[model samples]
Each structure stands twice: as C-alpha cells, then as structure tokens.
Target: MYCNQPPEKPGNKKELLEKITNMARANSLWVTAYGTGCGAIELRPLHTSRFDMERFGIAMRPTPRQADVLIISGYLATKTLKRVIRVYEQMQDPKYIVALGSCTINGGMYFDSYNTLNVLDKYLPVDVYVMGCMPRPEAIIDGFSLLMQKIKDGRAQGWKHYKENLDYYRENQKKIITDWDLPDYNW
Candidate 1:
C-alpha cells in the first residue's frame, strides 16, 4: 500500500514522511501483554533480544491504563472473559486490540469447548488479527507496525465504538458463565 502512498498534506509530503519515520523509530508503542494461553510462550522472542520489539517502539507495560496496545495472546476461557473486558475498559483512549493466534481468532482446538470463547472479537474490537496456532515474533512486529500507523492517523476509535455498542456488549456479557452457575458439589 505504500508504493505510492499519498502525502498527509499536499504541500508537505516530506514532512509527512518524516513524521511517520519518526513514530516508527520512537519505540513509542506501549503494550499490555494479556497472555491467556500456551500461545503466550511464543511472545518470549519478541520480548527478548532475539526479536527485540523494543526497537519498534513496542514494549510491555504492567497496566492497561498505561498501554496503547492490548495483545490478546491465545485462547480466552469464559471465566476470563469478564476480566478481559474490565482490563480493556481500563485502557486509555485510542487503544488497539491484536488477536495473536488462531485460537483467539476462532478458538482453534477449543472451538468445541464450552469454556472457550469462539473469538476475541466477540467481546472486544480487534484492530489486527494475526493468524497462526501461534504467530511468530516477526508477525507480531509487523502487527505493531500496522497498529502504529493506525495510532498515528488517529483511526482507532475504541471508546466511541464501545459506547455506541454498550448494550449489545452488555447482553453478550450476560450470556457468559458465572461462578454462581457452578453446582454445589461440596455441599
């Protein structure tokens, strides 16, 4: 798509290019790694010096509020769904969600499992979907690049999108299993 990408402003193509290049070099991406499954094991290379995502302005953060990107790495069970929504809501505006595996995209092997959600998009808006049983470090880096472009252009309207669809989300949230549903076997 960059072959003949249009300039941000007709009179200052060079300036636009520079702005994009700078963002790329800033290592400015703040990621909250929500590792939910075995797929998270693949994130090791991205965090380590081998892939060194730090070079792309993408680094892990401890809190969602401090994050600009939320990486859903692996399958999410029904019990974890609520926590995911809470965390996603806590993030600052313009945040992006990256589904890091086939399991997250379609539940992979857990498609038939009652506890596994079919797709992360069912609960959260996903900006980029990385397809693999587990995506490689390079794929993750590429996803980061895509996300940076979106952030730079101010196209990720997470807050507005969620607010408009709050009721739909609330109804979906209600369908998920709860602790109250567990039978009182101990009793």
Candidate 2:
C-alpha cells in the first residue's frame, strides 16, 4: 500500500527561486509515452476516467520535444533502444524517465533474447523504475507520485547525470547498436 500523499513543504532554508522552479516542475510533468509492450495495455487505463491521472498533473504528449518526462512502459529491444535514445535526447533539460515493467528493468522473460536489452539504465539514466511483470495502473500512479516527490526534493537529477556522462551512455549504446547513425544531440 504505497501512499500517494503530496510532498510536504520543505523546511530547509533553500533559495526561493529554486524551490519555486522545482514546484512548477513537479506539478506539471508532460509525458512522452513509449508504450512498447505489455505495459502498454496497463498504461491505457490511465487515460480513462477510472485512473484519472490528469488530476495529479501527469498528462501525455505526442512529441518528445514538448514533453518533460519519458515513460518507457516495456522492455527495450536493441532496435527500440535506438529510438528511445533519440527521444531522450530530444526532450528538454532536467527531464526524467519513469520505466515501468520488469522487462525494462532486467529484461524479465526476454532475458534470454539476444535482441532484448537486459538493463535499461546502462544506456540512459532511469529516474524511477516501477517493478512487476506489468505494473497495475495504481502502481503506475504511485510511480508518478514518487517521481513528483523526487522532483520537488531536487533528487531527480538523472538528466544531469545523463548530460555529465553522455560519452559513457553513448558507448554502452553503441556496443549494442551496430549500425548507429543517430544525429547529434541538440545540446
């Protein structure tokens, strides 16, 4: 039973601007969804009124450029990894990734498949990983809540890690993607 309570006001005497910026960032997370596998089925229920994800400030965006969060809802095949990297690069600064499903975490049932990526974090920084064969809509909501809390606390700095370690991520990516010809990042 994970609690989805809103983050408490920080009592730390931090800069007002930074606090406000994080508040805004945490409040409005535009998601770029890559519903690639079984988790896709689970993600759809979020859009319907039953889950009602919008009240929590999580909404879907069609393009990565317009989104702040990338939800990778399934396993990463070698081919899918390329597109995921491309999309991650296109997103704005201070972005975050919320990976769902055990497959995306450790290849799950696809661990034996040579084309399946065993560990997603090897290629890109993953901020939140919701475990389970297919995390239920409630669990996905809990994941988003966790991410929001991280953002508000300034703990969700995976984007910074990715930027500082771009070469490392790229190297790992290239090891699997043989015919790599992705464009340079817009940074």
Candidate 3:
C-alpha cells in the first residue's frame, strides 16, 4: 500500500531542488550485505549476469554507514536482531529496510519459535516486504524497484519515522531483545 506516483512538482526553488534530490536518491541505492537467515543464499545471485542488480543502480555496500538500504533476509534471531538494530541506526538518513522472505513478515516457519521475531515492522519500519520463503532475484529486483519508486514518491520515510518515534520503536525492540547493551542514538 505504498505511493507509486512521482511527487507533484512545486513552483519554489527549494521544492524543485528537493524533487531532484529525491530522484537521485531513488536511482542510487547502496544495500548493506547483511543476511540473517537462509534467504541470504538467493541474494548472492543478484550480482551474477542473469540478475545483474548493478544495472538498476543497486550495489552492495560493506558497511551500514555507507549503505542506503538494509535488506533483512529471513528469520531474525534475538541475538542477531540486536546487531541488526545497531547497524540500522548507524546508517544515515533516508535509509530503507527491505524485509526479504515470509519470515520477516510473519516469522515464516519459525512463527512459533521463542527466539525469532513474529513481526519485523514492530521493531523496524520496513519499506518493502519481498514475499516468499526465499524470494528469487527477480522478486528482489522488483522489490528494489518498488522501493525506488517509494523514494521518488517520497513515501520511503522509515528512517525519519524511526527518528521521530524512537521511544515507541525502542520499546518494541527491548521487549524482544532481552540482553540490550547498545548505545543510545545521539545523532
């Protein structure tokens, strides 16, 4: 249920500049290479000739600080969830989260598990949920395209929402993460 239309053009110079900035951000997406579960396997083929994600301006980043998107692939264990939150917070503004697989949406096969999170949106605002047990590279690409469209339409504001509603998100995160030891986001 995300907006797909390009934003309405404004008359002012600031608005015009913002439109251009949004377009640029939409086109260039640097995804962090952090996969939490079995879905990580499918992500590898995206770089191959058949998939070639780079053609769409999607590249893998080594660190969260340099990445624009964090693709949480598969079920998130409680231990890994803590690190994921840390990495996610380190990313700069306009960041996005792509939940790959049914696990992220509803915990998939691990829905009843004690350690896995039942819903990802409670802790992190997910921009796109690439459905399937392990979504194919094509689906992942489609998800990326959708995310890009969201960026262009100014609908991908998960990071901003996180910042504004930090306490609400933190409460959800703390409920699942028992051994919380991460530093507060002061930026």
Candidate 4:
C-alpha cells in the first residue's frame, strides 16, 4: 500500500532474515577515517600490521558514502563539528558512530574553548564510547568489537535515531555552527 506493493505482515521468516542480514553487516563494517582533531594521531596504528584491523573485518574507507562506521576522535571545534555533521548526513543508512577519547565525550582539555564543542552526543548519536585521554589501539579494537556485537544483535540503531530526531539534532548543530550554509539534505 505504501509503495506499489502491499504491506507485508510480520512473521518468523522476516525475523530470521533480519538476523542473518544483521550478522553480515556486523562483520563487514567499513570505518570512515575522518581526521577530526589531535585524537586522529592515535588511530594511525590501527591500520598497520601491528593492529591489523582487517583481521576483524574493519577497514577504513576514504569517503563517507562508502563507509558504514564513523569514528569521531579528539577535540571537536565548532568548525570540525560542522564538517562532521555534513559527513554524517552524507553517509548511507544503517550507519554507526564510534566516539573516541574523553575529549569527544566531555571536551577533555579543550573543555573551556568557546570554539570547541563540549558534548558530541548533543549533535550526533554515538553508538559506542571508547573512554580514555587517548584510548589505546587495543581499547579501540575492543570498542569496535562491542559495536560489532551490537550490530549483530540488531541493537546499533543510531542511524534510525538520527533520522527520527533530525530536528533536535539540527538545532544542536546550528547552535554551534552559526554560519550554516549547507542544504537540509545533502543527497
């Protein structure tokens, strides 16, 4: 009825298929490596042979459109927060955000800066928070694992939350990004 087809009723087959799909998505997570702030430096080793993120099926993609996971690391100034919102909007659905460091959660040392954002969650939905002054690669991997498990269990629904609460998020974003020029929908 909504599209050209009739509305399908809920059933066991649908649930089973959803579970299978979730498992597949959980394994094939593609991270968007956005260089937000000083925290970006700590993420360098994750791709090297020492960490080898691919072993866990997590690889960094160059663009937001191709990435499934966005890692917000370091202190986010208002300028960076604007770009982050734009990138987050560009990413396709079923996306997830992994916030790294105490800086991202509560602004860390940059808490007093008028230009830096104190709380990232006020602007975007964070699926996982890897807490540290600068979390170690092992801690980041552990965070990724937690995100994967959440994805597998079909609990990582930040994308849906973002879409549903678009107005609330937009207000928070606009408050920080005073010179808003981007369109409401990038796509």
Winning model by lDDT: 3
For model 2, the superposed segments whose C-alpha errors exceed 4 Å read 1-14
Q: For every model shown, what is its TM-score relative to the native structure?
A: 0.77, 0.90, 0.91, 0.91
lDDT of 2 at 29: 94
Task: Give the alpha-carbon lDDT of every model.
Answer: 0.72, 0.86, 0.87, 0.86
Model 3: residues >4 Å from true position, as ranges? 1-12
Return whichever of 1 and 2 wins on TM-score: 2
What clash pairs does model 3 have? none
Model 3: how far residue 6 lies from native, Å? 24
Order of the predicted models by lDDT, top scorer first? 3, 2, 4, 1
Residues 23-76, model 1: lDDT tens digits: 653348788878877778888888787898877767889898888777788898
Model 4 bad stretches (over 4 Å):
1-12
Name the weakest run of 10 consecutive residues (lDDT summed) in model 3.
1-10
For candidate 3, the TM-score is: 0.91
lDDT of 4 by residue, 82-173 (tens): 78888988887779999989888898888998888888899999999999989999999999999999999879988777766777888888
Range of the 10 consecutive residues with the lowest summed lDDT in candidate 2? 1-10
Q: Estimate, for each residue in 1-187, the C-alpha lDDT of model 2 and write its tens digit.
A: 1112323344657567777999999999999977657788898999899998999888899999889998888888888888888888888777999999999888999999988888899998999999988999999999999999999999998988877777788899999999999887354
**What is the lDDT for 183 in model 4?**
75
- In model 1, state the lDDT of residue 93: 56
Candidate 4 RMSD to the real structure: 3.6
Mind giving the per-residue lDDT tens digits that candidate 3 earns over 1-187?
Answer: 1112223445677877878899999889999999888999999999999999999888999998899999899999988988899889888777999999999999899999988998999999999999998999899999999999999998898877777677788999998887888886434
Model 3 / residue 41 / CA error / Å: 0.6
In model 4, which range of ten residues has the least summed lDDT? 1-10
- Please state the error at residue 74 of candidate 4 in Å: 1.1
